[model samples]
Target: MATLEDDEADIDPVKMILLDEEGEEKKLTTLDNGAAKPQMQKHYIRSIESTVAIRQLPSEGLSFQLWPAATTLVTLLDGYLSHLSESPLATTLTALSNGGDNGRKLKILELGSGTGLVGIAAAVTLGANVTVTDMPHVIPNLKFNVEANADVVARRGGTVDVAPLRWGEDDDMEVIGREFDLVLASDVVYHDHLYEPLIQTLRFLLNAGARGGEKKVFIMAHLRRWKKDSAFFKKARKLFDVEILHTDPPKEGSRIGVVVYAFVGKN
Candidate 1:
């Protein structure tokens, strides 16, 4: 099987137009050659008054870079932590917080944790124990971001653990376990070939038994790029109840923005 980097190398340079903090459209190009340099992007968690730094290696592959949807999810998490009742995640997070955990810190698992932005932000914002997982090759970068923000996470009484989790791998899933209160991901639904494996992994996490018999929730932030993306959701709905949690307004020259969805095991 071709590695993620190998697959990335086969594609032509991907041009992505993303919305900046000011909602301005910015163009970014991903090249196959090792021409892009590593850079650190800082995200401020207003709720904690601190910043989480992420390292991006664009030349490595998508797994080593930040995506626009990841930013949207992180922003929502920050707002949710700020006690903003109007936040898109307010209702869902509120229920998870009060769901008989007995005041214990929430345990979260993030899949396809590219750059670890969403997972790291969740750890800092929710004061939860978050495990960020991806392919083995991506663990190093994921750990770097986690360590870069360790102090901030510690200050919030949260912790982050990095692990390798290939979608559809039972052994990987077994090693990670299913004791988490929630699952998270962003920009993980792009590749058409990965759809089945991704959905299989979701089945293992959400449909399988969860801690305390509580149905686990999977929250994913995605930016639709192709019409075929609908197939993944169709397969997912067969095993889980899927709902749209939030939708970001489109940036200039775009028709759709990031959309956050929630998935849970069907009753």
Candidate 2:
């Protein structure tokens, strides 16, 4: 519903995004090469769809065409089904199963929500109000996927919004200026260049400003890349009162690791 993306800035929906076809640079066999530089160009097209069955391109530039690597987007239409563990599906379901007697209707937002799985899972299983966001580059495809599938989300009385959000630099949280019940992000801490900016963004968008929950409440998921991810987490912990909210790395040949994080407040 609210967004702030500079049209001039080029965006790559899949790569920088956690939920789509884009990959972790350390894992990318190409960018890992020392000889390569940040060549400003677009190269590929990958078909990605939302749970509702709307398909769009994840990689929308350059000459390369991409294929979904078992990870893709989900929508409200799928009714919040989760194929993976380590996801909040079970947690949310438990809470919601109580039947809202807790005076708690959750308002949640997910940063870098790839195919909308987590958000969708929360929406369906927990019936939390959710928002899915990503870079301007990925907004088009993200929205298209959401549009294609609205059925799943509609059933649980869950509402999902797709917005444009960038990890680094200027952010527009004002348009979305209200406080949230739960904030989440997945696979967003792998970039060194984005380190500080990501922290700043979190502080800006979260942190209850001496009011709300006495701090911000957030849960983040990432596949651990020791050096890069640990460094970021260590520094981030210094900024917020943090706890190892959760962790469930893939066993073997699972292709990815999964960890959950919860931040209480800012330092």
- Give TM per candidate: 0.89, 0.62
Instruction: Give a tens-digit lDDT track for model 1, residues 93-198.
Output: 8888888556698889999998999999998899999999999999998888899999999999999999999999989999998888899999898888999999
Alpha-carbon lDDT of model 2: 0.51
Clashes of 1: 0
lDDT on C-alpha atoms for all candidate structures: 0.82, 0.51
**lDDT tens digits, residue span 1-267, model 2:** 311111222223334322322443322223343433222212121112223333433234311122222122222112233424333444543433443345566677777665554565566555668888776666666665566446766766777888877764464565555456667766566557778877877787666642333444666665544343556766777777765544444433443445455676655
Candidate 1 TM-score, C-alpha based: 0.89
RMSD of each: 6.1, 11.0
